[model samples]
Target chain A: MGKLKVLSVGALSTIQDEGRFGYRQFGIPQSGAMDISAMQNANHLVSNNPEWPVIETAIQGMKLEAIDETIISVTGAVVTLKINEHQVPMNASHQLQQGDILTISKPMGGVYFYLGIGGQLRANKDFGSYSTYIMAGFGGMEGRALKKGDILETQGGKPFKKHVIKQGTKPSMTETIRIMKGPEWKLLKDLPERTIFQVDPSSNRMGIRLIGDPLGIDGKEILSSAVIPGTIQLPPNGIPIVLMNDCQTTGGYPRIGKVVNEDMGRLSQLNPMHKLRLKIIPLEEALEKR
Target chain B: MNILKEKELPLLQFNKVSWDLFRLGEQSLLLQAPFDIPIEKIHDSAKLIKSVLGSLLTDIVPSYNSIALFHSFEESTIIEKLSTARGISQKKSTPIQKVEIPICYELGLDLEHVAEHSGISQDEVIDIHLNDTYRAILIGFTPGFIYMDGLDERLACPRKANPRKYLEFGSIGIGGEQTGIYSLASPGGWNIIGRTPLHLFDYKKQPPMSVEVGSEVSYVRITKQEFESWGS
Candidate 1:
């Protein structure tokens, strides 16, 4: 019954969980947390289940006033954390007394950050998930982004005292992400021997629009087919679009590459205008790394 | 085999990704399918390949014309299964169930617009629309929103220049040679001619989806009174 009421929702905030899976055949996009690893780490820090619901914020952080005493942790995008005006570490769990105000600022490095509570966040669930799907107008706080003065409830349970902080290596923000050739790769005539497309400003959860030389292609319309979260589709415009968690279940655009499952986390955290180099890797090598 | 030879079904080839498996992230693999074909045939092929791969492998997603196989195994057994499955000949098509949906032309908000644009009477528009059975070519754009083909060519109409702010759930609309029903309220450019009471998507249902790939859908025209009486 414990909860954390929102005093002021920061610049960008949304409720997210692991994701809703196995329903793509129905055309529902898998809307979930953008940074899967960060969400997991944040949950681990609070000893909550790895897939428990958490709040994801963009560059600017959120401010919350605790309704009840509880333990929480922040992870991803290196944001400055404070509890009642006292500075706190981003990756460690801390107890907040009721009425204590927590403020977080924009990230020093990354574009996204996560706040993990010890228990589940109170939000309406749709299709067995609490993640927001703004396009469908369902889930989360009225199926849209969190605004200021929104109250968030959580099932406050006893916090685990023994926090196992498994520090993992953070991916370099500047690293070029590799992608395997897409199904329609052969259709492209003048593809760079080494492909690296920069992310465009128009990118969001729906998909990442890339800025690159038009990939020359054999004239043909690819049949509409199933698209996964990491699919890289090339529309007739010739610019490749990398689909994300909120992407459609199927599409007709030509696919030139698919980001390996392991690299999607990295791509999810990429800011606008970030450059990503696409190196072709063997499926075996990619799987081995996983 | 004799039927295949007589039908002249094109032989589909399976080619493996020559370069490294493109990594989308830590948990997914994108297996490429050959491109270049009619949209319907590509969809058919993707559905066929999806069924084959779904039956042969575990924990893989067959996305639009591509297969995204997921695995937690350290040994890459999933890759082996995919490669082996890809090497085989095309599998037989599985039978898909047919769903009959009832639509009330009176409930269509843009029926007059459709009639006026096509230079036909409202009655003529309805007549042309109800004359043919539509096939579900694919399911996309939104959950349970089926992409149907086989609209009467005479009734073909382009999508609206500007998308409507909100299309009522169950609204049936035509865009070009395709006509589909909206499973949920969404912004759309399609010319909505009518609406149905049937629920195409329900979260509590066992399968969750009312229609599936390859399902044949036929529309039954009902009167506004009949729709209201049926509690549509």
Candidate 2:
């Protein structure tokens, strides 16, 4: 058994795995790590299963004190890591002794950082998942973000060989996101593929709201239909909102396109106000890319 | 002998009910039926797809005139399987399950607002709500939030200008032409009329929700005392 006491949580941090599945029919959002592959890679570095729950913290950073001997790995977002004031490289596994203190700095780029421990983190499971869905107040550390003085407990883990995922191999901040036409794509009057869109600061796990030149078409409300992560919804305001991991199961906005699944992890890492452009791809190319 | 056996079976109709299947990215498919089609038929098609796809599908969402199928399976495989399934007869005679929800009108946060909007007395509003039978059409927006149909045209009211940040579980509300109860405590924009004592959603239970699409719902008025003592 291992324990890590959170000294300070600088931003929104919660436990997340891949996500909760088979619950969208009930209108439950699939809340998970914003960058799924980064979370998986962090778990992989710690010798944990890719789907095991890990601590997902936003850009502001956090501090933790190891209460027991454990192995930990950090991934996602370009963040600075320090152990007892000594700088350490991220995307690498580090063995921590009892009472060791670890500090993670805010992302130099990107938005979320993941901390993976080499064991299962104890958390409440709702609808067969440990992922936190804050809107409904269920899952992970009593259904809320980690706070100061909170203790995270883990069970059954053995440190494997410490390794590092080479920089640039993993998902990084990207300004170009590939997309495919959605069900309501035909309703769009103009397709501004070359227009550079800026990520809105108000964006969160629920969605990445974008600000750019309006598509010059009124978004006619459609019958509330099925929506999934990566769906780009155009509301009456003409601005686009890219549905993220915590998006609702259904929406009434016109779905113009969906960010390709392959680019979702990279898209999640884009910092607020980061400029990006959408590239619409053919279905054949999308299927091939996947 | 095989030909004779094949001749004994009923001829399968081709394209009797068709939905336009479109791809939503690589992992999802959206099948949209015409809006003019009956919602029950859409529900039937959704059920048929679920029964056909079974474990291949990760999640299936049935909306007003569309069904979204989430899966990692090859899109062509799903489309082919659905095409074959559509030819099969899906007519079933299962009786509709009716749920009588006991509501306390005194708890209605916007009861007077709805009464003023409808130009009717509060008692008449309650009477109209209790007498009509509603059918759950689609469940979305929030977990276990069922959108029901069969609202009286007289009681139709636009959604509140500002949505409430929090609505208690089982709070019944009317929005535009739709009427339904908030199955879970959520932020909503509907004009609430009453509160039901029945728990519409319990996560610990096997199904979590007692009400589902196609279930019949009716309100039963109860006094404050009865509401307080419910399930005690």
Candidate 3:
């Protein structure tokens, strides 16, 4: 099997993986791959199953076509690749064939971007997650995002042996990032010495609202609980947000800081207004390299 | 119990009871109960801290006065089975569980804005929302939404100051004193009034959410032609 079709589905694209686990106690939204280390290094450069199911995309640009001889690759952000029309390489692994095509484009400093594709991109999983939780439509493909034409079958593989992602092992769009303390870091107070912040263009995949410097309150609201995906809440106009990968397994703002899962893949390749800083560190060096 | 700020914490001494944990990163953990237990013993201490962190758990979550968990503290016997995770249930049981929910009160599009803002009378706002029986305190903000807890403090309101860009996947609402069930519509602001044909979240079931945090839903009302021939 090996279909792929689409032809333009850019401004979004979906699929994702390494998410949806045990169902976040059912309020759902684990929805995976907001750069889970550039989709596990583009499924370790197409060897696949580093949590399989790739394609994410989103910073505009993704065109597809390849109906067979497959084996793709295109790791995270910093885009601009192509295929039938030429220009390739982004993170390595290629083969294309069948009707060829490919493309990618829009994504300068990052916004999701994985691709991967060696076998099984299949679709429709929902609770078990095929990712694509576009505001809870369901999970991948039919669950929204990946528009223009939408074909995407996959079970392809065959064209093998090729891997890349090497130079310093890629991961630098850093604006400083690190973080830790959350559990309402004793109500934040003057903490801004290195906090900078900014990133809010209404952010999505559930959270990431950041705006900077307001933080320092004793408003005392708490109550709501259990949040995830790199927490960092703080909202009461002190503006902080940050949760991601479809956030909302439960929350009530006021988390304070969390980010460190290796800077949540550079905070999922930032973008809006950009500029960051945080730093903080220490919850065991932010779980050091769990 | 009341452990706050905590430094290198993790040593609650379990069943000998001394809870209040924290350290929500690197495998997660949040537990909280320095006092006032009974929420069915905080869901029986979140299912006995997931059977004392069995197989180093993976998720427990149980909110409304806390539970959280999400394992893998690189297992050094998980802080010795989380200082004994309170023997799973020191008696005093009552985990709740009822659930019924059929609703549709003429599709309650806010039932006349909750009877002209609770001055009461859309049949007394469906008789004070069928005389209470709620309690599902927090299934979270979306995905089988839930959030319940009684609600009839004179049918309290306060949420839709402009929030309905859609609202229609099993609707059922109310805001302030809580009440829920949008399950998966997308945009919201609560106050919906009526609409439940079950499926609180069937992503092919198996705990695909159907009321949990402490269950006991209730509702029943039915009518828009039995909410269009509802089923399962």
lDDT of 1 at B89: 34
Worst 10 residues of 2 chain A by lDDT: A166-175
The lDDT values for all models are 0.72, 0.85, 0.74
Best by DockQ: 2
CAPRI verdict on model 2? acceptable
Question: What pairs collide in candidate 3?
Answer: B14-B83
Query: For model 2, what is the error of residue A7's alpha carbon versus the real structure, in angstroms, after optimal superposition?
Result: 1.4
Could you give the CAPRI-style class of model 3? acceptable
Candidate 2 TM-score over all chains jointly: 0.93
Q: How far is A30's C-alpha from truth in model 2 (Å)? A: 1.4
Model 1 DockQ class: acceptable
lDDT of 3: 0.74
Local accuracy of candidate 2 as per-residue lDDT tens digits, A121-225: 999999999999987887998889999999998888765677899654433343789998887776777775757888899999999999898775554798999
Q: Considering summed lDDT, which 10 consecutive residues are worst modelled in model 3 chain A? A: A165-174
Q: Candidate 1 — what's its lDDT? A: 0.72
Off by over 4 Å in 2: A169-174, A217-219, B1-15
